[model samples]
Target: MTEHGRPSAPSLFDHAVEEIRATEFRDDLVVREITAPAGVAPFSLAVAADIRPEVDGVDSPYGTGRFILLHDPDEPSAWGGPWRIVCFAQAPLEPEIGTDALLADVAWSWLVDALDSRAAAYHSASGTATKTLSKGFGSLAEEGDGAQIELRASWTPSGSLSPHIEAWAELVCMLGGLPPGSEGIAVLGSHRSTRG
Candidate 1:
């Protein structure tokens, strides 16, 4: 116990890391924090990643997108919480999928299923899903002219967040938008598909 009375200067980032380690799924994902440098309170947050599947997979040119969670100390009017967990996923899609409503529905399921499967406690989730198609006319290299889908959501972590943390890690893996239970995760079994 230091002068701060609560403990030491472990910082929020350190706490988050310890939380990730104790959650039981940290090894399968890459966890890191992204600090927003221009904000008043220094909007620092962590992300646990599960890369997306590619055409060739092992040698695929681009990576599978991500399901990201964000935490902020400054309470926002909309989220109504000191910390908000945000989720998102972007993956190259066939041109035909650009207009399909299933994209949004499926993306939404990824989050919901993850939460339910992991029995995570959370509330007040809200956000949108967007389909983006690359467009440009320049010699500079750019993302291919393929379609991509992004799903965004924000929520507050409820008490005893161990379940929530496990769910979030699985959610990141799902956001890769690949068939779950592939490489390194098959042994864990596809928990999302077992909903009954």
Candidate 2:
């Protein structure tokens, strides 16, 4: 080990971190470094991202997400590699759209599509998409119904790490209901068709 206890100076993990820092995301996305969860890997990094964070003390109505990169030189069997990327993204949705049976599948597909679009190579990907519906009760009855979609996924990543993070950021914005390449643009609303 090097003096720093790393296998070498500027280890692969360090390079990964640098790649993530240099990644470019949408102007509307606010990406901030956060504490990486301990005990998962010898080296790890994490970041939190929010779309349109806040304006005048009002929280963003878009969405929020987290990206975590873990590196274990041992090459964990499940990860299929020394590097693994885990992500979580959630967004509020129109109450009507939440009831759609295909929402979960579509949410998962978005993730795959984002990664493919960016040409990020990876394998051993697994994840789940969840939809939540809530209704106001009693004093809160006036609030009516609300819904949200959440996606959690992890995959072993190959090649340069920048594209993977970029894909993740894009996925977050997409879930927030923004079209591709929508940076710096104002969204009027999202339109969904009703099933009769």
lDDT values for all models: 0.53, 0.83
Clashing pairs in 1: 52-64
Can you list the residue pairs that collide in candidate 2?
none
Q: Tens digits of per-residue lDDT for model 2 on 1-196?
A: 6877766523778888988999888788889898999999989999989888775233256877899999988889989889899999988887878899999999999899989988999999999999988887899776677788899999999999988898888888888888686777774243321111
Candidate 2, lDDT over the whole model: 0.83
Off by over 4 Å in 2: 1-10, 55-59, 188-196
Error of 2 at 115 (Å): 0.6
- Candidate RMSDs in Å, in order, are 7.7, 4.3
Which candidate number would show the highest lDDT if scored against the true structure? 2
lDDT (Cα, tens digit) per residue for candidate 1, span 15-45: 7546655665434444444433345223344
Q: Estimate candidate 2's RMSD in Å.
A: 4.3
